[model samples]
Structure formats: structure tokens, C-alpha cells
Target: MCVVLAALLAFELFQPAHAQIPNAAQGYQRELTRVVQQEWGMNGRVAVHAAQIHQESAWRSNVNSPVGAQGLSQFMPSTSAWIAEIYPDLGRAAPYSPGWAMRAQARYNKWHWQQLASAADECQRWAFALSAYNGGLGWVNRDRRLATAAGDNPRVWFGSVEKYTHRAGWALRENRHYVRHILLTLTPRYERAGWQGGAPCNA
Candidate 1:
């Protein structure tokens, strides 16, 4: 009886909280899959991207944040315009269009990932990339510099660079939560649900 109880407790501890995928996420899976593959190749972190979209707008294509971020990917107007301008193939800035938003998000993630080559590992790199996505790459760089000055390893994220942020309290909290929620929480959930491209942090 004790052994059986221990096994049940272990199962409960290992099980994911909210393991079921959101219904709204179902409609965009195909498009997201294609965009992630197109941008990051076949082994792209599709589950991570899906979790990002879930965090951004909960797969709602028509929602808008009070801060003016719009649509499924929750891009601000200026950012949408900038992304479209820099990547001409993306054409006009249409944050409301599901197809456009998915592609733009995938492209933008690739862009950030490419710039964060100094991270200690893929997990650290993606944490920085996601932080850059939530806040800005400038903030990530600034925090890394601060971390270095404090004698911490700037290449690491968890207890290193994440502890050296200079942003406002609210901004810092949101940015940290955004990175953790997407990478540690939601990414694993999506991976277990059979989304392609396994979680990087888990890898």
C-alpha cells in the first residue's frame, strides 16, 4: 500500500497543470506550424511559439491590449510597421491578419534568436530572446552588461542576468514572468499536447 501511494503521489507531482490545449489555439495550429518551419526550419521551437501566442492574446485575433498591442501576436502598431518595413516580403503591417501575424512573429523570433549568440546554451539563449521579445533587445543587452559589471555571468539567465535588470519594477516583473511562463510553463504543456519542435528549455 505504501508503494502504491508513493507511485500515485509521484504521478500527481509530475503531471502538468492545465494540460489541455485551448480550443482557440486549434484554428491557428496549421498556420503556426508552417510559419515556424519556414523561419526556423523543421526543428524550430514550434511549441514555444505557440505558447507565446497563447500568452499574448490567448489565440484571439481581434483583441487589443490597453498598451496598443494588437491581434494574435499582440504587436504594437509601430512594431508592426517596423517589422513590415524591415522585411519587405511581409508586405503591409497587418497585425489583425492571422496569417500575417503568425509569419511576422516567426520571423521576428528568428531575428532575435540570431542576435543572441552569446547565451550560454539554447535554453539561456531562448530566455534572452523571449525577454527581448517581451521587453526589447536593448534592455536584454543592458541587463547583460549590468550583470557582467556585477561579476555575474551575463551568458546565463535564471539567477544571473535576470537579477541585474534596470527597468521599472512593473516592467521587470512582467518581462521575467513572460519569459518563464512561455518557456517553462506553457512550452511544456504544448509539447505534451503533440506540438512539433520540442521545448528548448526541456532539451
Candidate 2:
């Protein structure tokens, strides 16, 4: 009995803390699925998007960050306005609306994905896109250019362009952590929880 109890304790201790789906995220699965499919088609990386949302707002529809980011997708006011303007179908900037936030997040991620054609692979492309989402596409572009100038592979993200940022140390750390946390950590977590899309990094 002692040995059996010890084995059970070990199993529980070894389990990932985030292995379970977040309670806040449970309510939005259907809406997220619909939005992701609409924006990215059937094979869209829903898990990746879900993980992004997890990082952004932990599925809190009413969250407002100290820096003025808002809602589930955590879009800053300026970004929300811009996205609404560019995609008029999204209507007014309603960052606090769960539906709007999910759709806007998908659209914004798609926009980043479209511009990163030089990425070495799907995984690298997503890393660039996520970095763009966290910081700015201009930063990623400059970093890639700098990496190229230094003989690093501009198409790669992890050890290449990610190492060439011109942003301050804090911003650089946040961006890199944001990309890796979403793609490498949270993506797999969402995928394992039975989310429809698979992890891009695992591809």
C-alpha cells in the first residue's frame, strides 16, 4: 500500500500544472473554434490562437491591462481601431466583446502570417508572427535584417532573428518569451486538451 501510494504521488507531482484547460477558456471554445475556422479555414491552427489568447488575457473578456490593452485578445485601443478600420466587417472597435476579440485576434494573426513569407517553416513563421503581435512587425523586420547582416539565417526565429532585436532589454525579453510561451508551451497545452488544431511547433 505504501509503494502504491508513493507511485500515485509521483505521478501527480510529475503532471504539468497547466495540463488542464483553463476554466475561463472553457466557455469560449465554440466561439473560438468558429472564428478560427472562418479566418484560417478548416486546418487553421486553432490551438495556436487559443494559446495566444491564453497568454494575452487568460480568456478574460473584461480585462484591461495597465498599459491599456483590453479584452480577451488584449488589443490596445489603437490596434483595435486600426483592425476595425482595415476590416470594416468587424465594425466598431469592441475589444471587450468576446466574439469581436476572438475574430480580431484571428484576423490580426493572419495578417502577420501573410507578411512573413520568408520564414523557414510554419513554426518559424508563427514565431515571427507572434513576435510581431507582441511587439511590432517593424521590430521583427529590423531584427531579421540585422540577423541577415550578421550572417544569421533571417528565415529562422528561435536562435537567429530573435537574438538580433534592437528593442530595450525588457521589451526584447517580453517579445521572445511571448513567442516561445505561446508556441512552445501553451500551444501544446491547448492541443493536449482536445482543441481542434495541432501545435505549429510540433509540426
Candidate 3:
């Protein structure tokens, strides 16, 4: 019992200070916390979602991408419409509603992850998943095949698939940056939350 208590105390001592959710993002952070922790059981990786919120629109509910992605998670109008058709409550929520947009993001990520089930671990899994979230899954998969044909592990992301994406013409930098940024944002927060080995190269 004494050893257990000490272990727990050590864990608490090393945890990072709470994430500094921005003032304008008060409600957005709250809803994101709820979705990542409660609905998705991703409490250890809330920062990945937080990273997307930051990258996509800097937590702005009203922001719109030049490509037509709107809201905190930057869903395209057609994608938003499709999400709404599949999830009535989530889709019905205003595009500017942080909760709704993030909920959609979580929903999309859940489905997106299914397509990469062969990923070696959390690192590889999220790397490919985030890339797919930015670029199309079809393209990410095509690159994965290219990497494998060139003797890389299709299941490993960093040195394998991500390396090949640099030579990919369409959105090459964007796709690589998407995965890198998410890992950067995710690792710090998750480590603070007691998660282990979430780096881009971990798997």
C-alpha cells in the first residue's frame, strides 16, 4: 500500500500543468474535453483533438478555410452535410457551434481510424489517421503502397509512409505537416496526462 501510494504521488508530481485553453475557446475546450474523454474514451490523448482544433481554425467557431471547410474542425460543406445526414443531432447543430463541429470531428476520426486498423500502435495509427483527415484516405493508402513497394513498412508511418508523401505532388507538405503538428501537440498534453510513447516515430 505504501509503495502504491508513492507511485501514485510520483505520477501526479510529474504531470504537466493543465492545458491553457484559450479565453475565446472556453466553450470549445469544454465540449472538446467532453467528446474526447466521455464519448470517445480518449482521455489520454485529448491533445490530439485539441491540436486539430488549434490547427484547423485556432479554436475559432466562425472560421472558414479557402477550400470551404468551416468551423472549428474545418469540415467542408458537403462533408458537413453528409455527417449531418448520418448523425442528425450532430449535423443539426450549427456549423459555428464548437461542440457540434468537434463532435463531428470525433465521429469522423472514429470512422477514419477503422481504415487504418493495421497500424502498429498509437503513433502509427494517429499519423496515418491525421494524414487521411487532411489528405484523402485513398491518396494516403496509395502512398502507403508506394512505400511498401519500395521496401518500407506500410504499417509504420514516420520513416515509411510519411517519407514517401514528401514526393507526392498534391498537398505533400500539407499532409506531412498535418501529421507532424498533431504529434507535436498531442505528445506534450498526453505525456502530462500520463500517457506513454505517443511520438510520431514511436511505432
Backbone collision count in every prediction? 0, 0, 0
Which parts of model 3 are misplaced by more than 4 Å? 1-21, 42-44, 166-170, 186-203
Any idea how many clashes model 3 has?
0
Q: Candidate 2: lDDT over CA atoms?
A: 0.87
The candidate that achieves the highest lDDT relative to the unseen native structure: 1
Q: Write the per-residue lDDT of candidate 3 for residues 1-203, one digit (tens) a residue.
A: 12432453345445454564454654555566778665567543566777677778877889888888889889887778887998886647466787788888888887788889999876688888888888878888988998998998899887678877545465898888777756654345544553332333322
Q: Select the stronger candidate by TM-score from 1 and 2.
A: 1
Query: Model 3 Cα RMSD, Å?
Result: 7.3
Candidate 2 at residue 62, lDDT?
A: 97
Residue 130 C-alpha lDDT in model 3: 89
TM-score of each: 0.92, 0.91, 0.78
Clashing residue pairs in candidate 1 are none
lDDT score of model 1?
Answer: 0.87
Candidate 1 has its poorest 10 consecutive residues by lDDT at 1-10
Model 3 lDDT at residue 194: 36
Ranking the candidates on lDDT from highest down gives 1, 2, 3
RMSD of each: 5.3, 6.9, 7.3
